[model samples]
Target chain A: MPDSNTNVIEIRNLTKSYGKNRGVIDVSLEIKEGDIFGFIGPNGAGKSTTIRSMLGFLKIDSGSISILGMDSVKDHTEILKHVGYMPSEAWFYGDMRVSEVIKYAADVRGLDCSEEARKLCERLKVDTHKKIKELSLGNRKKVSIVCAMQHKPKLFIFDEPTGGLDPLMQKRFFELINEYVAEGATCLLSTHVLSEVNKYCKNAAIMREGRLTMLDSPKIDDETFLSFYDDEG
Target chain B: MKTILTKELKLNLKNFLIWSLVVGGMGFVCILLYQSMETEMADMADAFSNMGAFSDAFGMSTLSIASLKGFFATEVGTVHGLGSAMFASILAIGILSKEEEQHSAEFLLSLPVSRKKVITAKGLCVLIMLVAFTAICTLLYCLAFLIMGEGIEASLFIAYMLRVLLMNIEIAGICFSVSAFSGKNRMGTGIGIALMFYVFDLMGRVVPDLKDYLFIGPFSFANASEIMSEIEPKDSSFIVGIILTVLGVATAYWIYDKRDISS
Candidate 1:
């Protein structure tokens, strides 16, 4: 029942809550195969909530989610095998060297990503010899990027991936993403950066306070990007 | 499963070594000291037995300290039982929760592995460490006995160690359930649970009204004095402990798999 050309990610009336946190309510969206879908929303606008729910991190109160044309909860193991997720703040074993961490991730997925991992380290300027505790925030981000990207997954889900990156590194990060897209990978980029959305995302969903303000807002320029970014869409 | 198992085993090695050394070393030192205290122990055993409620609580009233077996049953047995239980509690209580406490669950669960497999791997770590701790401590005790020029009753010693292992497994299983329910490290609470069980067993031995309900706590079947004396452990307590351990592990899987994991 797994359809390779079906919607890469789909959510229908998803709802979740945690105490007073503004958990996503009735959030729904779909990303087609090979689409660079931007999930643009401010902090606490349910971007991470929706994303986490899709990955089966948070249990939804109602509604459903499916990934790669399979039930998200029922087929979670299968879905994750083809998806590469980079969280907002990546935490790794501090005692391990960067190379060991990469190998550990690869080992978990039963993957041999040595060559790809080496290339990603070089592209991201990651120092493989240093322990994770010794790295700066930007360097840690680079390591997480390699862990998520080295597998060359069919779907890439990055939640605020550029937070600690320098401007140059951020540009290079997009370059890598673009290269992956060219290789037939679908991506879901969750960020509040309007410029990244306008520059890269052909179609984006804007969220405000746990609600989707704009569903699949087509390509827009700087002015319209600002309006949609400000919740004026 | 292999990946998580290897990673957890590697991460937990230092901790396991430290705890094993502390408990096993103390037991070894205590056993070595007993050879020098042999004459005094024969005289003081009477006073200890007469200590009334305190002696009853520690099983000293029933098992004299005049002989090596009695001394081991009353002293070294207490050390191993309480030490291993605490170790099992602390180890299992944090294995799953530490991922969230360290903010690594988001990274770990995001991988291709399922939550069930992750918890199973951690549970296996707790079980393996408990076994290793028991083996090391048992070996240290045997060495101590050799140094003291005493021969242990092999069957009794083996039975005691097996009982201790079962008790630790039960304690660890209970705490494993707690770890799944609590997203944060609760070492203090785990230690508290171990101590509470100790007190329950202690009180159950000293207080007649509580004796019948000893089956509720793990120590009832693991009473060092009873095991050394070849007295059959309360059958009800043994059966209940096994049932609870099964239920505890089952509950852990149910709760951890169903509950939402926060970043």
Candidate 2:
């Protein structure tokens, strides 16, 4: 772990609930600058809930979340300016062309991402001229990836970013993320795929049923981790 | 906000155009029919004057069917008012919920903009579209009167149109507030609210005792036929409408800011 002073994200007793069921319960974790933190969880494991609360997308029941030393709820707009987010499902205005969607995203962030977007599109083999509705799921994911990374934000929050990509594309996605981390950027990658986490992450947090069950290193073998997960179940 | 507004306007351009054309076309056809029926309107008015229950039920009690404005108010205006209310409610309901329904809320809320800014921008877009639809319909009304070799008093025309516009805005405000509170069921909730208000208005007209409580429905305050015939609008209903609108929009902003976005 990095020093406490360099913590990019600090969560203290974060709690959220949907009706009577708990969405997240007293979940707290810290990530320092430049750390590749993996948030591993199965479906309904509260991974998305935690990330969304951090991003100010969902109103939490109680506790605090600070990003880049700024209160997540009070300074959400300012905090988001320095962060890049890619959601699991890539959905956009179906009527717009891929290029228009990217341009709109860039415009919203007040950035000129044309060049970077073009390069990413070329690398990912995405067709910019095609309408978003016509693109395959994998291609739409590529568009979302380009939109997220084009701005080169200080922090990246990716939720199941490689769900629709092929093996080759997934490799390239990891390469892009690794390069970003090498530039002293922090990443919070939420996914259930343990192989990718083993290959890319230095630290990992596993969640189960709205609780953080394990927070450790990915140095443990896949079989051992799966066995531990099974024993918990 | 500008980015979101532009995208929203572009997405709903087709919808706005369709609603405007439908209302305008109906008005135009009614005006043309009025030109041919002008000779018989005196007799028609005499016949309708005795049907108190029917006239009150349809809000044709005060309008003189012999005049072009009165006839338009009684027939075309009533239909257009209902249509406008439905259209405005749908627009308000769809503004925010479409993102969630399409599974695009995650991508949108993740942007650098605040939730307040997003909702404000969406509200602005809906307002602009409603104003555009009203303008188009007003221009068509003017053109239709001109073609029939008749003209409406400028002040009267403005007053009538303003009443319609205000009613639409009030309906939109209530529906938008409901939409903000609802999740995926926003459209249904909005429609239900609109239907409830309309039913209340109709019941108030049919029952004498409930007439005093007409302030509860937006339709009671801005009846086109009443406005066209009267010199001044009823102040109590006007004040009630303004209050409802302000309360609705303010409540929407408050709830949307605090609500959890589960999708």
Candidate 3:
């Protein structure tokens, strides 16, 4: 477990909703520096909503989120400078080549990611010359991975990061996460895949219907953990 | 902001080219028709005057198509105005909603940039594209005039083009605000707003009672014939256009700042 004194992300009663639809309610979490935190939830369980709210993407109805000791809403632009995010569904300009897409990401973050991006692409075995539209799902996922990692942000937020990766690539991705954690970076991995949380995360939070139902060390097996969904229904 | 601007420009370059060609082509065809119809100018004028309902709807009641400038103002200018307004509407509506429509909002909004900056950058890109489209249309108009060996007063022509540009920006601002507040229905709402404004302007011209409400629609401010004439430009229309644009943009910014991004 990471030292409790060095919390990288602090959420207090975060609530965001769409009209009457439930998004997330009274969600609060604390992720310490260098901790591999897993956010486990089924489809439409508000995992993305919570992460997006923390990242200042969605406006909250009530509550507060602070990252790196700065308020997420008030200091959004500054906070983003130190964060790397991988969304659940990867998308890019369809007409752009893979290299151009990566370069564009680097440009947006004001970083010269050429060397690191090239190395990451090589390691991920992603083709740099293919148009974004022509890349397969897994390949596009690889591009997103490279883009997210190239900046070497202090905090990494991954939403369903392994959806399109093969088993081999998924293993390699976990290894990369471990490497980053070893370097004192915090990671929030949101996924419904219980096996991923059990194998990699030290602490996991389970969400159902836009509320956190569990937050503890991963002690149950994958099948048992998934049975929580059935029990709730 | 710079990065977003560059990306927007890159993505919409093809769209800009296509819209320019369509608008410019309409101008070209109109100018060519003027040459073929020159000999029958008197008859054409009489026919348009007799078609009272049609003239009122098109704002051609007082226009004499016998002259090249009058024909260009009433026919070519109206088409160009409508086309440019549509293009602006599409650009504004697509600016923010396309991300959600394509399910890429997650990827974009996750970046370090704030939501306000994102909107500002995209809005700037839309404005720049509208300016470019207007400039291209103006150049095409000038080319047609030169080919037909007709020289219009340079200042009047410029004033007319400036009005067109302002009108387009006004429509874009309204549509952009609509997009910010709406979700999947943004495009439909934007186009509908433009169409409604157009219909309102037509009604204002056709119905004497509604003429007093001409300030409600943007088309009322964009009078091509008045612009081409030597009379001083109407400051009331300009003021109204400016107010609507400011209000629209301010509303957009405020709503987007508070709105939730639905999954």
Q: Chain B TM-score for each model?
A: 0.98, 0.93, 0.93
Question: Per-candidate interface C-alpha RMSD?
Answer: 0.8, 1.0, 1.5
All predictions: root-mean-square deviation over Cα? 2.4, 2.1, 2.1
True lDDT of residue B18, candidate 2: 93
Per-model TM values vs. the true structure:
0.95, 0.95, 0.94
Q: Model 2, A1-233: lDDT tens per residue?
A: 23435989999899999889879999989988888888887788799999999998798889999999999999999999889898888898899999998998899998898999988888888899999999888889999999888888889999999998999999999899888888878899998788888899988888888888556577667776675457364
Models ranked on TM-score: 1, 2, 3
How well does model 3 score by local distance difference test?
A: 0.83
- Comparing to the true complex, what docking class would candidate 2 get? medium
- What is the TM-score of chain A, computed separately for every candidate? 0.91, 0.94, 0.95
CA lDDT of B2 in candidate 3? 96
- The pairs that clash in candidate 1 are none
Residue pairs clashing, model 2: none
Highest lDDT: which candidate? Answer: 1
**Candidate 2 Cα RMSD (Å):** 2.1
Ranking by lDDT: 1, 2, 3
- lDDT tens readout by residue for model 1, A15-117: 8889776698898887788788888766787889998998989988999998888898899988888888998888888888999889999999999999999
Docking quality level of the chain pair in candidate 1: high
